[model samples]
Target: MELWFTGTNAGMPIADRNVTSIVLRLAETRGEFWMFDCGEATQHRLLRTPLRITRLEKLFVTHLHGDHVFGIPGLLSSRSSLGATAPLQIYGPSGIRELIDSWMGITETHLGYPLSVCENTEGIVFEDGDYSVRCAKLDHRIECYGYRVEEKPRAGALLVDRLERAGIPPGPLYGQLKSGLDVELKDGRIIRSADVRGPAIPGRIVAVLGDTRPCAGAVRLSERADVLVHEATFGGNLADKAELYGHSTAEQAALTAREAGVSRLLLTHFSSRYGAEDIAELVQEARTLHPNTDAAVELTPYAIARARNES
Candidate 1:
């Protein structure tokens, strides 16, 4: 899996960065990418990267903040114009559906694809065989949320050599064995799949949070995740100011990742007052607590490698 930072600035746009937006590009995409947030001019940001709005299957809005959702209408319309016929599912806090409904209604924007808006609360909002998504309320000015994506564990690799050594040919019998069924051989012997297969491979976990301060919800949502994408909107020296504004400093974000025992911490949503040079200080502060930490750069794809134990 790869994480693409489309926007990483806080409050306003900087010369090099836009507001808060992150796209979770699955390496094994079933024809869709999951977007964490769509900030203002996010479609324009996608134009700079290899990502496309048409390929986005789901949009998870952290809050109704303009910097987090102002691009919804534009992105939707652009996808329609691009001849995307797939349905789009949007999940967010209450009033999100109404907000988009009003925006589209006022602008008289027409869309060809079907849109499904879901106002989410704390719990497992989405689940399927491949993945499950859960959300939790976070400390912010409004009803903000954090999401956790957990991929399902996969069956172990079939032991082709072991089966061949046992005089089992690779045919329909291999299929039955792979499906965890015992295959009866012509010699009146039974072969078990589990006896020959390797250990099951653990799935990956990803946590993505919107604008929020250091809180338990953040830790709960990000616990032991392979990648924890937390907003670090202030510098270490500005801890008091960050709390007053319901934001977290880079150091605090690092602390959260450490407490959650996450493998990697990606700090983003930096205040616009800081320039590119200032980001070094933020990242350094985070590294003081969590060594596996990095400040996210806009349009860069950060690869999420599987944890050692998971592998």
Candidate 2:
């Protein structure tokens, strides 16, 4: 899996950063991409990367902030013009359907494919054969939410050496054994798949949070995650201002990551006040508190290798 940052600003666009948008790229599947928080000018960010807009399968909105969702209508319209025919599904908190309907209705924009909008509260929001996404309410100005995506565990690989030692040669029987099926040999003996298979590999977990303050929900959503993507709208010196604005600071994000026991911390949603050079100081401050903390940048993509022993 990988994470691509389309935007990483706090409230508005800065000279260096945009707003708040990200993409989750699944390595196991071809042409599959899921998005979180499509902020304004998101399409412009995609232009700089190799990502295909038509491959976007799902969009998860965290709140109703204009900086977070103003690009939706334009992106959706452009997808149709680009000859995309696949259906699109959007999941978010309440009022999402009304907002999209109002915009589409007012503009009289028609889509070539079906669009499914779901406004939900705390529970399993999305699930497919390989991934499952869950959400929880966050402490923000509005009814914001945090998402936890967990990929399903993969099957073990066939131990070719063990099979060869057992007098099994490479052939169609290898395929059957890999599929966890029993194979009957010409000698009237049956070999079970478990006898030559390694242990099943656990999947990786990624937690993404919207605009919110440091609260229990953040820790709960990020518990034991392989990567925790949280918003750090201010520095530690501005804790009061961050709390007043219903946002988190770099120190707060680091504390949450340490408390949640996450393996890595990715901090974004930076205020426009900080320049590119200043981001290093912010990252260093966070790392001082939590050793695994790092800041995100626009158009940067992070590839996460599959867990060890994965099939």
Estimate the lDDT of model 1. 0.90
Which pairs of residues collide in model 1?
Answer: none
Candidate 1: worst 10 consecutive residues by lDDT? 302-311
Listed in order, each prediction's TM-score against the native is: 0.96, 0.96
Residues 65-184, model 2: lDDT tens digits: 998999899999988888889999999989999999999999999999889999977989888878899999899999899999998887688999998888999999999998889999
Q: Quick one: RMSD of model 1?
A: 1.4
Model 1, which residues run further than 4 Å from truth? none
